[model samples]
Target: MPATSYLRRLCACLALGLLVGCRPEPAKPLDQQLYVWQRQWRPAHEQALAESRADFSTLRVLALQAQPQAGWSRALVDLSRLKADGRPVIAVVRLDGQLPALDLDVARTQIGQMLADWQAAGLNPSGLEIDHDSASARLAGYTDFLLKLREQLPPGLKLSITALPAWLDSPQLPALLRAVDSSVLQVHAVSNPRLGLFDPVQARKWAERWSHVTERPFYLALPAYGMALLPDTGGVPLVESETPLNRGGERRELLADPQQLADLGHQLRDKPPAHLAGLIWFRLPLPGDRRAWSLTTLAAVARGDALSGRWLVELSSQDGLYDISLVNVGNLDQALPPRVELSAEQCDGVDGLSGYTLQALPQHLVFNRQSSARVAAGGRRALGWARCIRIDQGAWHVYP
Candidate 1:
């Protein structure tokens, strides 16, 4: 080959290499944060907020509720008591869809009044977020309402909306996005029992699709809370309220698994979309809220830690019978074994509870068919009592 031809080939190869090297890498995963939705106002929540403030960039507070007849009902959140520690706060106002027709003027007036009231009380919020799950047919009305509300907001105050997944492909979504500073896509909700809440696969697809269509940055909201459902005679699961019911029914709980959240974190870290701002938890964790994730579990999940199950077996004596309680002391949910056998020299027979089936063996009590014994993290369940010939000190072994 001639010297000129060889030089040209070398130069072309160098240029191609340079172009490949200069190409930008995929974006990193967004930071994860919390959303405070508890309105009862407890000191423990305040402490948790103070301690975990470093993990979050902003705190979202529930400030108002839009009603049909009354217009807007102010939620009893004591803004003065919530210490932000210099972090910005976004006041979240929820809309109850009880009105047959939405009045844009009424919404604007109520929002303006609430903002002014906050200003008067010496609370300066950095943003205002509207939480409304609008149907596809009502997207136009919802967009118009948001536009009017945005006009009345104080200058320099950012506006945001909590968006439903079903409305992502609607043509009116562009109009609504244009009217707000940012939109939060809530990926966790309990509309069906079979699918459970927080389908990670579906959520990832939605995030990818939204990123391609929108230029505005958005946050992906994940769940840290669980739901308790009770099946009626018709076999439909009904959500249980905080109040106790007079009727007897079987209860089942759906918890947000830490492993699932950690897996999602890993996926996002590898190839997070460009338009994703970060992740926002549905609500902050409280120690007393059994349905919500614990602070330790949340931190571990955010750090992309793989969780393992740990069980603690405790034996208690009541009415001349030995009761065994299986407690999940770890930060992950565990599936109860199909059959659990306890071997003890002094045990004769065992009695089954509502959650498990019991069988008597030669020298052990076999607990079988435990289909409903799923225990949440930090939850405890009694494994029924064992009937013995007499009470005496003896060694016990558990077999899976």
Candidate 2:
């Protein structure tokens, strides 16, 4: 075949899902969305949502969840505030993946009541998203449930599902995708905890392959949070997110790197899959939500802004006692620096808390980070305190 003929052939097959070798066509910029995964809405949410207004355009709020032993657990969301926000809202219903079987009737009834209450309260949800992590072999039954739910829903209201990449190999996957208006392909924390969160290479592969299986538009559910894995005698570590575990021991912390995710977003924009729509960040961060990204960092990543963290050591004194803190003045979230040192004379006492250790030397007091914990943009961390006579104010240094 001539070069011109081959070029035409490639263009003709670009949008078709028939060949895995076909390259994706250039796509429009993806829209940004967020998952409000908190079960309880508080006054803090009002501020978090307001600050996120400029970046995210849609909200997927947790409406209800199915608990195996306790039946249904509904979220206490502020519907009036949601309506006031004026963004497209998608109500989410979560069914625990661990459940042996789903009771269709109970699910339908609970869903109906929730939707009715929302509608009756004058806040209309733009869509419904079902978040269930069913085993690959059970997708047939799951399909039936979704199909029935779709038929019973009000007309023109969208229905979507939280899809896992593990379903890619299952033959029944196509039918499941067909039952919904869209899907949120969750790419973060889907694998073993040891592998870390948010793999850009694997994520791209999943999105590209998923596009071949579904004709409907789908969003990628990326992580904007962290998790703590506590050692368990049963082999699998106890995974903690948003909620705390009373059992406290040495644990491994995994955080989704903002720079890495931002780079992936850029790649997807440059070469996006067919029918790929947007990104839905998992669980928006609020004040004191230590496991999540700050809104400043999240917004910067969403907009593909430059990332750089600026840390300054400022010491406040009262008599001979001095308080030390590191303040981040830049837009990026950064890992704790290796060491911070301050020149002092005749130090009587010194201390460091959190992830830092304090050392009192002959001429300087050193604060060393003991872990890879990070500080957020525009955030502050206390490096503990010190009591000394005649400390040099101009000799503090922070080492990266």
Candidate 3:
């Protein structure tokens, strides 16, 4: 081999090595990546503010007020405070344990008083949520009791409930859900302190179950406080050593530092389950409480909304001419490659479908199956077909 030729080949090999090194490393999985860091306190708080201002009409904050205690009353007062602070919506009480099977007269009187107190405090909402662990056979009687109570509720006030994931497998579950205007499924894993943070693996599985069970609108209840299941003499939840803690104990106290909350918001944003109307934190207390969760923590979870600029876009329809209009569903927009294969619900060649196809207007971006059409706004109004999907009948997403 000639000396000059040998040197040239060596340089070419070195250049190829440099190109491979310069290419960015493949992105890390979310759970493996270092959490986003906050450079200054101001931005962290501003992030908190941005979350407060984001549109969460689909979200509902569950404020647990069981029976009548100063804590419950205080929680109700705080509901008005948060509502005034611009929080979109909230659920006044959380019902867990065996309360659902209680006689209606007892439950109704207690609930009515809570509603009366909420109204007195200038926090009037017709929707009341009852949250409980799943007991399928008992749900029938529970639904009947709720229907009776609904008849007596202030007209237009809705009744809602929080369900356990196991209910999804139960044949009676859908009927139970039908009794209310909406339902929230608590998706966190319940574990013993010795076991560690709620198992993300199990949590994901349950999230999928609830998502499939409740095909209609529903919210996802996230864990703000961690629970340690005590040793039970038999198959029941033990409370002798009941202490609600989070993933990292004091170090990972979720609601205390803005960053920790942001981390949670980050986790949620990365892996949002389906039919997720919005996120809910466990409980709320006075602005700051170390042991008990507070409105601040709830606010912190709300703060995660800043990352929610996500929209699921799909090419919904294609006319005989093969022109396609991409449909954007949910609040966030999805970035997809041009002219690729996508799921059918995502974009169909027919109106009211979702997927992507390479084509130009006169195109329509129909938001949902029902709406006639929406005007294409990013200035390429060549007029194929443009439309907005409605989450329901009246709500429409603004398109660019």
Rate residue 175 of model 2 by lDDT: 92
TM-score of each: 0.74, 0.87, 0.48
User: 83 in model 2: Cα distance from truth in Å?
Assistant: 1.8
> Per-residue alpha-carbon lDDT of model 3 for 149-206, expressed as tens digits?
7888888887778777767667877777778887776655444444454455565677
**Stretches of candidate 3 above 4 Å error?**
1-83, 189-194, 227-274, 283-288, 291-400
Which candidate wins on TM-score?
Answer: 2
- lDDT of the candidates, in the order given: 0.75, 0.90, 0.47
- Candidate 2, which segments miss by more than 4 Å at Cα? 1-27, 318-321, 344-363, 370-372, 386-394
Q: Which model, 2 or 3, shows the larger lDDT?
A: 2
Per-residue accuracy of model 2 over 1-400 as CA lDDT, tens digit each: 9999999888878746556657565478899999998888989999899999989999999999987787798999998988889899999999999888988888888998999999988888989999999999999999999998888888999999999999999999999999999999999999998788779899999999999999999999999899989999888888888999999788788889888988998998888898999999988898778899988999898998888888888889999999989888999988789999989999999899778999999999999889777788988899989999967878888896
Give per-residue CA lDDT, model 1, range 282-365, as digits (tens): 677766665677676676677676787777766777665788777778877666756666665466657777477777666667
Output the number of the lDDT-best candidate. Answer: 2
